[model samples]
Target: EPEVTQTPSHQVTQMGQEVILRCVPISNHLYFYWYRQILGQKVEFLVSFYNNEISEKSEIFDDQFSVERPDGSNFTLKIRSTKLEDSAMYFCASSAGGVHEQFFGPGTRLTVL
Candidate 1:
């Protein structure tokens, strides 16, 4: 079955450096989203994208964070400057449409020091 795939399973970076996390979601899904889970916290939504535009974003997704689909098959999240709090497991997910089950990627573990 098709599933989302993220690159660089683990990333270690300095507190102020920029980082770009990449993901490739299922081909037929129409909605894409980025989410993060701090160490022991529950998953938090960051942003949602559709039709090449941001459909909605959470307060957690501040000016420093951005998402884009450079092409048909890839989705990406960029953090202009990393903060210690930004260290978490970032996941990429997609759903076919409303009420459909979302498929999530294994996740990219980002570590900031």
Candidate 2:
């Protein structure tokens, strides 16, 4: 089975800066999602995308966050401006469709100063 993959396993950025977390979800999956775990908190959904458009997004996913599939295999989350509260482990996940299990990436740890 193919697994989701992410780059820059660790990222340290200054507050108010921009960061783009990259991911390559399982090739065959049609639904993609972005989730984050704030250190000790539970994993929280950020956004979900399908058919090259955003399907849903949480309140936490404000104007500062955006998702895009620039090419066939890459899905990315761009944080226009980072804040101290934004530090977390960002994960990428993909599912074949409804009711299917979502395979998750190892995650990119973002640390904002």
- Clashing pairs counted in every model: 0, 0
Model 1: lDDT equals 0.95
lDDT of 1 by residue, 66-93 (tens): 9999999999999999999999999999
- TM-score, each model? 0.97, 0.97
Cα lDDT of model 2 by residue, 15-86, tens digit: 999999999999988999999999889999999999999999999999999999999999999999999999
RMSD for each of the candidates: 0.8, 0.8
lDDT of each: 0.95, 0.96
CA lDDT for candidate 2: 0.96
